[model samples]
Target: MPMTVGALRETAKGERRVALTPETARKLVARGLAVIFEHDAGREAGFPDATYVAAGATPADAADVAARADLLLCVQLPPADRLTALRAGTAIVGQLRPNAAHDRLEALGERGVTAFSLELLPRTTRAQAMDVLSSQAAVAGYRAMLIAAEAAPMFFPMLTTAAGTIRPAKVLVIGAGVAGLQAIATARRLGAQIEGYDVRPETREQIESLGARFLDLGVSASGSGGYARELSAEEQAAQQAALGERLRVFDVVVTTAAVPGRPAPKILTAAMLEGMKPGALIVDLAAESGGNCVATVPGQRVNVGGVTVLGPLDLAAGAPLHASEMYARNLLNFAGLLVRDGGLSPDFADDLVAATCVNRVGEKQPQLI
Candidate 1:
C-alpha cells in the first residue's frame, strides 16, 4: 500500500491556512502517494472537498485520517485530542515551536511520533525552497502595507486635482528581512514615499534595491547566520532616542523586526508612539512575539491618542488562498526528504531533515532504526 499523508483543519485560533492545497495534493498524488484530508480542511482557504477529490485525494474526517495516515501535515500543533488519537509511529510536520510546547514534545516522543518542526530548518541554499518562514513573511509583509493603507485616514498616493495637490503618504518600515522588504515594495507600489530601517547596516543595499530610501538611525547589530544580534542597553537607548524624533513625520509606520524563538525586540517605545503624527498608523507584524511596539496588544487595534496601532495576528490567514498555496508548496518541497517511492524511509542524517525532526522516528523510519 502507498504511504498515506493527511492534513486536518487547523484548530489554532484565527488560523485559516491548510497544509494541503488541491494543487499540492495533486502533485503528491502524482508521486504515487495517497493524499487524505479532513472534510472542510481547505474550505476556509476557498477550496472545497470536491477540489481535493478532483486532485486524487480522499476526504476523511480528522478521526479517520488520524487512524489511517502514516504522516500528518499541519500548520500548527495538532489539537490535544487529535494528538492522543494519532497512531504510534506516525510522523508529524509543521511549525511546531518545540520550546513553547515542551509537554507536547515529550508526549509525542513518548508515543514514538517523529515530530518535524519546519521552523528549525537550517539557513542553507538547499532549504530555501522549503523555508516556510520566508514564504509566510512575504505574505505578512505584503499584507502589512494593505492594512496600513486601509487604516490610515490619509491617501497613499499624491494627487493633483482642482482641490490642492496633496503629498504622498510617508511610510517608514522597520526591519529588512523578507517581511520588511516586501512591506517596502508593497508600500511603494501603493504610491507611498517609503523608507526601510534595519539594525544591520549590510541591509541598506537590499532596502535601497527595492526602491526604498533606507533609514539609518546610526545603529548596527549585524549578527552571524544572516540575523541581527540583540542590541546592548546603551545601543538600544541611542536607537530609541534617534528613532523617536523621526517618528513624527511618517504617516504610516510598519515594524517587522523579529527574532525566531525569542520575544520581539522593543523597537517602538511608548514615547515614540506618542510622538508620531496624529491620525497616523502603526502596523506591527511582530505582534505575535509580543510586538515590536510597547503599545501594541497582540491581535488587537489600539488607539494611542489619535494614532492607530494594530497588532494583527495571523495576517497571512487574512489572505488565505495565496498564503495556503505558498505554504503548501514549501511543505511539498520539504516532503521530498521524507517520502520515498510511496513509503517513508527518510535519511535521518540528512542535514535538512535532522535539523527539523524534534523526536525519534522509532523503527518506522528505517534510517533512524
Candidate 2:
C-alpha cells in the first residue's frame, strides 16, 4: 500500500498559506503517495477545495487527515490540542521553531512522531530546492524594500522635470544575507542610491555585485555558519557611533540584521534615530525577533523624531499567493527526498534529515515547546 501524506489548515492567526498547493498535491499523487488535506486548507491561499480534489487529493477534517497520514505537512508549528491527532511513527515536516517550540517538539517525540524543522535545512547546493528559509526570505526582502520606499516622503528615482529636479532616495541596508541582498537589488532597480553592511566580510563582494556600495566597520563580527555574531559591549558602542554618524545622511534605512533563534541585535539606537534627517524612513525586517532598531514595535509603525519606523512581522504572508507557491515548492522537494518506495522514511544518517530532525526516535511526547 502507498503511504499517506496529509496537510492541515493553518491555525495560526493571520496565516494565509496552506502547507501544500493543489499542483504539488497532484505531483505527490503521481509519485505514489495518497494526498489528504483539511477541508478548505488552501482556500485562503487562493487554492480551492475543488482544486485540490481535481488534483487527486481527498479533503477531510483535520483530525481525520492526521489520523490516516504517514507524513504530516504543515505551514507552522502544530497546536497543542492537535498533537493528540498525530499517530505514532508519523513523519512531520514544518516550520517548527525549535528554540521557541522545544517543549512541543519534545511532546511530538514522546508521541513517537519524527518532527523536522524546515528552518534547520542546511545551506548547500543539494538542499537549495528544499531551503524554506531562503524562499520566504526572498519574498520578505522584496517586500521590505517596497515598504521602505512607500514610507519615504520623496521618490526613489531622481527626476529632471520642467518644475524642478528631484534627488533620488538614499537607502542603507544593514545585512548582506539573502534578505539584505534582495533589498539592495530591489532598491537599486528603483533607482535609489543603495549601500549595504554586514558582519560577514565575504558578503562585501556580493553587496557590491548588486550595484550597492559596501559599508565596512573595519571589525570582524561574524560567527560560524556565516551569521553575524553578537558584538562585545565596547565593539557595539563603536559600531553604534559609526552608524549614528552615517544615519543622518541616508533618506531610508532597511535593517535586516538578525541571528537565528536569538533576539535581533540592536543596530539602530534611539540616539541614532534622533540623528536621522526629518522625514527619513526605517524598515526593520528583524522586527519579529525583537527588532534591529531600538524603537521598532513588531507589526506596528512608529515615529521617532520625524522618522517613520515600520516593523512588519509577516511580510511574506502579505504576498500570500507567491509566498505560498515558493513555500510549497520547497516543501515538496523536501518531502520527495524523504519518501521512497511508497513510504516515508526518517533517514537520520542523511545530513539534510539529521540536521533538520529535532525529535528522537521511539518517543511518545512532544519535543517542541
Candidate 3:
C-alpha cells in the first residue's frame, strides 16, 4: 500500500495559510501517494473542496485524516490538545518550532510520533527548493514594504503635479537576507528611494541589484550558513552610533534583522526614534523575535513620539494566497525526500533528513533551537 499523507485546516489564531494546497495535492497524488485533507482546509487560502477533489485529493473528516495518515503535513505544529488526537508512529513534517514548543514537543515525543522540524534543515544550494523559512520570509518581506507604504504619510512615488512637486519617500531596509532583499525590491517597485543595510558586507551587490544603495556602518558580522553572527558590544555600539546619524534622513525604516534562535537585536533605540522626522514610519518585521526596534510591540501599531511604529506579526499569513502556494511547494519538495518512487522510504543517512527530524518514533531526542 502507498503511504498516506494528510493535512488539516490550520487552527492557530490569525493563521490563514493552509499546509497543502490543491496544486501541491495534485502533484503529490501524481507521485503515487494518497492525498487526504480535511474539507475546507484550503478554503481560507482560496482553494475550495472542489479544487482538491479535482486534483485527485480526498476530502476527509479531520479525525479520519488524523487517524489514517501515515505522514502528516502542517504549517505550524498543532496545539497540545490536537497533538493528542494524532496516532502514534505517524510521521509529521512542518515548521515545528521546537524552541518555542517544549510542552507540545514533549507530547509528540510521549505519543511516539515522529516529528520533523524544517527550521533545523541545513542551508545549502541543494536544499533551496525545500527551504520553508526563505520562501515565507520572501512573502513577509514583500508584504512589509507594502505595509510601510500604506502607513507612510507621504507618497512612495515622486510626482510632478499641478499643485506641487512631491518627492518619493526615502526608505531604508535593514538586513539583507531573503526578507530584506524582497523588501528592497518591493520598495523599488513602489517608486521609493531605497537603501538596504546588513551586517554582512557581502550583500552590497544584492541590495544594489534591487536598485537600492547599500548602507555601510563599517561593521561586519558575517557568519556561517548565510546568517549574521552576533555583534560584539563594541561593534554594536559603533554601528549604532553611525546608524543613528545616518537614519535621521529617511522617511521610513523597515527592520528585518534577526538571528535564528535568538532574540532580535535592538537596531533602532528609543533615542534613535526621537531623531526620525515627525510622521516618519517604521515597520519591524522581526517583531515576533522581540523586535529590532525599541518601541515595537508585536502585532501592534503605535506612535513613538510622533513617528508611527508598526510591528506586524505573520505578514506571510496576511498574504495568504501566494504564501500558501509557495509554502506548499516547499513542503512538496521536502516530501520528495521521504517518498521515493512510490513508497515511504526515508533514508536516515541523508543529512537533510537527519538534521530536520526532531524525534524518532518511541524515542525522545535532544532537539536544537
Candidate 4:
C-alpha cells in the first residue's frame, strides 16, 4: 500500500499558513504518495477545496484523516489532544519548537508517535531546500517594514512641494540577518534612509550591499551555523551603551535579533525609548521569543512616551499565500527523505533525517533536544 500523508488545519491562534499547498500536494502525489488533507485545510491561505482536488488530494474531516495516515504535516505543532488521536508510530513533521513544547513532545513519545521537528535540521547545503526558518523569516522581514511605515506619523520618503522640503524618514534595523536585510531593502524601497546593525562583523558586507550603512559597535560574536554567538555581559553592556544613544536618531527602529530556543535578548531599553522623538515607531520581530524591546508585549501594540512599539506575532501569516507556498515546498523536500518507493522508509542513518528526528517509534531522543 502507498504511504499516506495528511495535513490538518492549523489551530494555533493567528496561524493562517497551511503545511500543504496544491502545488506541493500535486508533487507528493506524483511521487506515488497518498495525499490527504482536512476539509477547508487550505482555505485560510487562499486555497480552496476544489484547488486541492484538482491537484489530486483527498479531503476529509480531521478525525478521519488522522486515523488513516501514516504521516502528518502541520504548519505549527498541533495541539496535544489532536496529536493523541494519531495512530501509534505515525510520523509527525513540522516546525515544532521542541524547546518550548517539551511537555507536548514528551506526550508524543508516550503516545508512540514518531515526531520530527524541522527546526532542528542541520545548517548544511544539503538541507538548504528544507530551510523553513529562512523562508519564513524573509516574509516577516518584508512585512515588518510595512507595519512600521503604516504606524509612523511621518512619511517614509522625503517630499518637495510648494511648502518647505521634507526629509526622508531615518530608519535603523538591528540584526543583519535574513529578516533584517529584507527589512532594510523594503524600507529603502519606500525612500527611507536606512542603516543596519549586527553582532557579527561578517554581515557588514551583506548589509552594505543592500544599500544600508552597517552600524558597527566594535564587537564580534560570530558563531557556528551562521548565527551570532551569545554575547558576554561586558559586550552586551558596551553594545547597549552605544546603541541606546544612536537609536534616538532614527524615526523608525526595527529589531529582529533572536536566538532559537532561547529568550530574545533585550536590545532596546526603557531609557532608550524615552530618548526617541514622539511618534517614532519600533517594530520588534522577536516578540514571540520575549522581544528585542523591553516594553514589547507579544501580539500587542503599545505606546511608550508617545512612541509606538509594535510587536507583531506570526508576521508570516499576515502574508499567508507566499508563506504557505514556500513552507510547503520545504516540507515536501524534507518528507522525501522519509518516503521511499510508495511507503515509509524511516532511515535515521541519513544526516538530514537523523538531525530532524526528535522521537521515533515510541522512543524519545533526549540527546537531540
RMSD of each: 3.2, 2.3, 1.5, 1.7
Consecutive 10-residue window with the lowest summed lDDT within model 3 = 360-369
Which has the higher TM-score value, candidate number 1 or candidate number 3? 3
Q: Compose the digit string of candidate 1's lDDT tens values, residues 136-251.
A: 99999999899999999989999998999999999999999999999999998999999999999999999999899989999999997678988899999999999999889999
Pull out the clashing pairs in model 4.
none
Error of 3 at 351 (Å): 0.7
lDDT of 2 by residue, 1-369 (tens): 789999999989888977899889999999988999999898888999999999999999988988999998888987878758888989889898888887788878888888889888777889899988888888899999998888789999999999999999989999988899999999999999999998778898999999999988766686776576777888888888887898889999999987667788888988999899999999999999999999999999999889999999888887878888889989999997689778887677788888888878553322321
- Taking all chains together, the TM-score of candidate 1 against the true structure is 0.95
Which digits, one per residue and each the tens of the lDDT, describe model 4 over residues 206-316? 999989999988888998888888889999899888988888789999999987777898989999999998889999999999999999999899999998999999999
Q: What is the C-alpha local distance difference test score of candidate 1?
A: 0.89
**Between 2 and 4, whose lDDT is larger?**
4
C-alpha-based local distance difference test score of model 4? 0.89
Question: Superposing every Cα of model 4 onto the true structure, what RMSD results?
Answer: 1.7
- The residue ranges of model 4 lying beyond 4 angstroms of the native Cα positions read 361-369
Among the numbered candidates, top TM-score falls to 3
Estimate the TM-score for candidate 4.
0.96
For candidate 2, which ten residues in a row score worst on lDDT?
360-369
